[model samples]
Target chain A: MSDLQIKDAVKSYGNVDVLHNINLDIESGEFVVLVGPSGCGKSTLLRMISGLEDISGGEMFIDGELVNDVDAAKRGIAMVFQSYALFPHMTVAENMGFSLKLAKAHKSEINEKVRRAAEILQLEKLLERKPSQLSGGQKQRVAIGRAIVRNPKVFLFDEPLSNLDAELRIEMRAELIQLHKQLKTTMIYVTHDQVEAMTLADKMVVLEGGQVQQVGKPLELYDDPSNMFVAGFVGTPRMNFLPAEVVDVSNTTSTLRFAAENGAPEVVLPMTDGKLAIGSKVSVGIRPDHLHFSPAQSGDLAIPIDVAFVEELGDLTYVYVDTKAGTRLSSQKKDGRHNHGTTGYAVADTTSMFIFDADGHRVRA
Target chain B: MTDAIASPSALASNRRKIKVPSLWTVLKWIAAISVAVVALFPLWWMFSVVFAEAGVPVAVNPRLYPTSFTDGFAKIWEVFEETGYLRAYYVSIMYTILTIAGVLLISSMAAFEFALFDFPGKNALFAVVMLSLMVPLAVTLIPTYLLVAQLGWVNTMQGLVVPGLASAFGLFMMTQFMQSIPKETLEAGRLEGANHFQLYWYIALPLSKNALITLAILTFMKTWGNFIWPLVVSNTREVYTVSQVINQFNSPFSHTTVDVVMTANFLAAIPPILFFVFFQRWIIEGVQMSGSKG
Candidate 1:
């Protein structure tokens, strides 16, 4: 395994810049995921690292050597495309062994490497099958097997699981994690699915519009996002942003207020400093799980509400409350939970709420 | 129960009433056979003329069958020995094969380049190629003859084969077919460490077998019957194509030996007809499929 470093990487088509000033250092054996929405230039960045795309302005170092001008064949990197681009005419084994053949490796060595990769991917039975004959999951495995047979220092995957069905996507995700553990090669994966990024990556880079929003472990990003985009983008059901005004600020906490049309409780968040003066505006952030329903005496103030809806998934139930603050918000709780009241605990006992100013930057406490 | 039974019976009667077009079926067959006969009349007449005797009267009244064969196949063989017919056949065959080989090589390379790579002046170059398609081959006749003469290639097979090696139709057809191959396939091959030559040889070329075969068949046929360029360039009788020789069998004011000439003409048609029969499927099915897919 070899570390990869990219410094001041920029990609542009004529005047329109697609990726701007991207800088990252990935350690050897690290599984880093570049996750963002479509057109975020994450795939372009991965292609650049693979040397499939020309680097417009940047220095890229692989194993302590600059490789920006290297040809894709000389870069010693293998990629698994989202389309599972197995040569439709070649059988699975031939597809896996194609790179070795191109390198003029010994035929025996090529066969041994291909067999090993097939074993690792559980594709021994599929050696004679063409891509058109295989299921989507099987085709994906062959694509990965082809990459593994190259035995490159770095492995790149461009949304390899995006084409599989939901159940197969989860299965492949687990298998990929296991594959990484066994191979321990430096891997850079690009995907628009946040769930895949959170589950598979040791270090996740959330990009938006060609810029990195946040780079950290999954939970660190969930707990402390650098900005509102990262906060809203990194979570499921998304972190609810309630527009509030700071009513009063003390040494340790601030009382916040939002119009409670359905008799909902006042929005209150704890603050470590008096950054916002009285009557100043701010936004309060809270996770749905952070807000749970219990007896009115056990938690914060309660207000009457007409139940909007409920969703139960065996272990937990989601309560949709209007709060009558113009838009509705959801709270997750144990099943058989009914609060006839709108108020619930803010997140949890251990989870602290987030606050952001008007510019969508996190208000540092 | 009676109501349900009556409903199904009534539905059956309604279906039978809707099926009132058996007369259309009979008319359809009549129309189809009439069209087939009309299309085949020229071929039937060619056969009738080939077998008719030299002295027998083939009337304008149109006898449906042959009367006799005084010249028979012997006269075609005599023509084969007497005139430039044998050399014409050989020249046409050689030119067709050579043209097919050149078109396959040059046009496929152009197609792969246009389909895969992005370079400066690519669109302009491709536009030039498409512009060649729009320009009729006849417009370039004088210039091409002058260039061939300057190159000292007149009356040589090189004069016939080299000028139109990279056929615009072949390039256009192949480029369109190659473009239909997803970009991911090429990128995957690149990531597999295949160089440009290897990608072309092992991936693009193999994947484009249908289009290549189609272009080969069409190019061979076009060159086999090519008269204008061959007639202009090949001043020697030894270098004439079948089309030129077939024209030589004609005389405007004299009594042309019609049966002997027709037999010779029929024999002349055999090579291309055999070629078409052997390879028509590839062009009709494979090329059309590739073009539509692109």
Candidate 2:
């Protein structure tokens, strides 16, 4: 097992840089999930670490040895590709044992390693089958088995579960977590799915536009996002941001005003330190689950909302609404009928509101 | 449910209304067979003439079948006794084998390089190879003959084999086939500690067997049947390939003896036919590889 370090790593194709100044330290036995949208250079970063791609700049160290110039095999890393890429002509046993055979390992040792991997993956019955004969999930298992046989210092997975169906993706996510625990090797997994990053990562790095947006524990980034991009990207159903203006300021509270009908009053945000100037623009951020409807208010601000849509997913309901300013809003509804129309409106209390300045930075108390 | 009760009467009327194309099917079969026979008649006629006596005229219209293989053999023996027929046959086979082998080696290696690697001027080099394919071999004949003469390879197998080795068509075909092989497979091998040579040997070479076989068969048949290049390159009977030497028995200006020439031609055709029979499976596989759905 080894810790992998990337210092000031950059990649450029000719003049245009695809990855810019990427610096990360993955400790031994840590599962670091690299989550990003497509074209964010996450896969390219992984490939550079794996030595499959040439690093355009900076140093890479694996196990305290600089490996920027090392070949993939010599780097002691294994990768499971999104396409599986199992040798179509080779049987499962042959595919699993290929690396060992190439290294000129003894026949008995090759068989022993292959058999153990097969047993762990429940692939003993599939040892005789070719890749074409296996289903997608089975082929992926064979791919992982191929990786497992190498027993590398680090395992790189490039969207390994993206090809699987939703149910299989969930099942395989658990299997991968279990595999990481059992092997306890430094593993870097790349995916676009936030759920995968949250569930599978010991540490998560979210990237956008070839740059790291934030790097921290999953809950840390979720609870406190540094910027607007990380805030909107790190959560499910996404954190909602509503546009508003500061109407009145006080020592402990500030009133944010938006156009409303005669029955709806303007919402006030109670800040620990009154920090806003009147008439200044601000954005209010809210986690959907933070919003709760109350008949009698005991706290700050309440805004009447016009419910636009509802998604009732058995355990919880997501209510899509428009604020009094006609800004689109989403809030989690836990009780009563899960309303599913645009016309019927409801009220959510002030604690749900997350205020931001004009720059989309969150306003923290 | 109501329709089920009335279906037998309705079905009887529907069956009466339907007109099967049994007569048209028979007519179509007749037309197809006629076309096939017309296409294959030259091959059949060549076989028939190969077994007829040299002096006896086949017929004004030609015989559908030959009299006997023994008569044809006797005439071919007469021709052989008069000239070095067996020697020519030996030279032809040797030259064809060498040419095919060299073409396979050169073309496959070039194709592998062109298909797999990205170096400086790789596309420009590939474009040059494609450009070579557009140049007619006939146009290069005189220059090739002079080059062979300057090299002192005239009347040698080198004259026949060397110039034709790096066949542009073979290179193009093999490159297209090798391109379809997923790059991931090669990457997988590389990650497994297989070096460049090992990757080519263990993954590329084995997987490209179909394309190689297709190129080999096509190259062999083409070299075996090539006439003008070998004729222009070789000055003596000692270096004549089967195609060039088979014309030696024909007296085009006089009363031509068909059987002696046909028998030699018939025997000359057997090697390529045998080659094709052995490698037909590879041809289909090659075509299928080229036809992969996007």
Candidate 3:
């Protein structure tokens, strides 16, 4: 295992920059995941770390040694691609031991390493099978096993679970977590799936427009997003954003009212910093889970809504409703009693509400 | 008893419906058969002339089938002894083998780079290569012959094999095929410490097996029947390809009978026929894939 440092890394094609000044420090044995939407340079950043793509600018170090010019093989990095990328003509054992064979290791040693990797991945019975004969999940296991047998300092996964079915993806995700624990190798994974990022990452890096948006522990980013983008992107069903204007500001609290009409829902949040001025426009960000059908306590803002739909998943139901101003929002309910086309109030908890200013930066105390 | 009788009638109706072909389907089959017959008639005529007795006027008789198969065998032996047909056969086989090997390797490597890599002027360079295909081979024949003579490759196997090795058609087809290989597969090889050449050899080549085989068959057929180039280069029988030796039977000074000429042509056509018979499936598959991809 090795620590990797990318310092002010910039990747550009001709005059257009794809990734800009990306600075990340991945500690040894840490499972770091870079999560973002498509074309956000997450895969590009992973390729740079693996030395498959040129850095274009800035420096990279592996194990505290400068390796900006090192070849991917020489960098001691192995990558598992989204496509599985197993050689179609190669057997499972050959695919696993390809790196060792390329390095000209002795045949017995290659076989031993391949055997160990296969055992770890539960692929012993498939050692002689070609990739074409394997199921999607088995192919992915072989891809991961290929990386494992390399004994590389770091393992890079470029959305390795993206190709599997949902059930298999979850199964593989759990297996990946177990693999991380068992091997304790420094691994950097890239995925557009936030659930995968939240579950698999020890340190989650949220990226947008080629720049790092937030980097922290999974729950830290989930509960305390640095920007509106992270607040919206880090959660399922996405966080709801309502246009609001600061109606009143005090030394210790700021009151915001949603919708321009009078008697709209209003909430007061603790803000000792006095950053908001009266009549200043801001967005109220609330997660689906944080919105409740019944207010737990007084002082929660209750917004009147027309129920658009309800998605029931056994113990919980997601109530999707449209506010009077026509902004759609989703509220999670444990009682699961909500129905379509019903008029009711969904309470937004004051303590859980996040306020972002006109620029989409989080408003903090 | 009434239900059983109704069942037989229903089954008979269904069978009658299935057995009758639509007029459009019949027309398609008729058109296809007409084309097949038109394409195969020349071959039938060649075989008929080869099997007819020596000095027999096949054009006058217009026989659709062979009259005497032994007559063709006797004429083949006569031609083989008199014209050193075996030597020409050896030359053609060697030329085809070398040229196919060279073409597949060179074109596949070139296609691998063209399809997968990015460098300055890549599109422009590929455009130039494709543009060369537009220029007729006959247009470049004189200059190419001059160059070959300057290099002292004329009258040699290299002269026959090397000029056509960098086949634009092969490269184009292989590039289209190679482009369909998933990029992640190559990158995986790169990460596994395989160099570009190793990736081409181990991954790209295997994945392109169908395209390679298609190109080999095409090159085999073309080089086996190659006439103009061998005629221009080979002044002696030592380097004469099968096509050139067959051309010897048609020369005005040779006084060779029509049956001997047709027999020589029949012998030259056998290898390509067998090659096609074996690998026709891959040829069709390669053509379909290249068509869709390109």
Please name the candidate that would achieve the greatest TM-score relative to the true structure.
3
Off by over 4 Å in 2: A246-255, A258-280, A293-299, A339-355, B1-27, B53-56, B59-63, B76-82, B251-256, B278-294
Q: Candidate 2 vs candidate 3: which has greater DockQ?
A: 3
* Residue B193, model 3: Cα distance from true site in angstroms: 0.7
As for candidate 1, its clashing pairs are A290-A347, A291-A347
Better of 1 and 2 by DockQ: 1
Task: Put down candidate 2 lDDT per residue, B1-294, tens digits, no spaces.
Answer: 255465687879988987777998989999999999997787788878877655444566666777678987776776677667788779888987898789888887888788987889999988998998789877888898889899999998888789989788888888887898888888888888899887877878778887877777667667778888878888787877777767776747634466666777777777777866787786566546545210
The stretch of ten residues in a row with the least summed lDDT in candidate 3 chain A is A292-301
Report the C-alpha lDDT of model 2 over A1-365, residue by residue, as the tens digit: 89989999999999999999999999999999999889999999999998889999999999999998998889999899999988887899999999999899999999999999999899999999999999889999999999999998999999999999999999999999898888898899999999999999999999988998889999988988877788889888898776677888888888877544413467766776557889889876678787644434334545566676777787788877776567776778776356344544345567656667888667775
Window of ten residues with lowest summed lDDT in model 2 chain A: A292-301
DockQ, all models: 0.75, 0.66, 0.76
Interface RMSD, per-candidate values to 1 decimal: 0.9, 0.9, 0.8
Q: Candidate 1's error at A196, in angstroms?
A: 1.5
DockQ of candidate model 3? 0.76
Instruction: Write the number of the candidate with greater lDDT, choosing between 1 and 2.
Output: 1
lDDT of 3 by residue, A166-244 (tens): 9999999999999999999999999999999999999999999999999999999999998999999999999999889
Q: How do all models score by TM-score?
A: 0.89, 0.89, 0.91
Rank all candidate structures by their TM-score, best first, as comma-separated numbers. Answer: 3, 1, 2
Cα error, residue A112 of model 3, in Å, equals 2.1
Q: Put the candidates in DockQ order, highest first.
A: 3, 1, 2
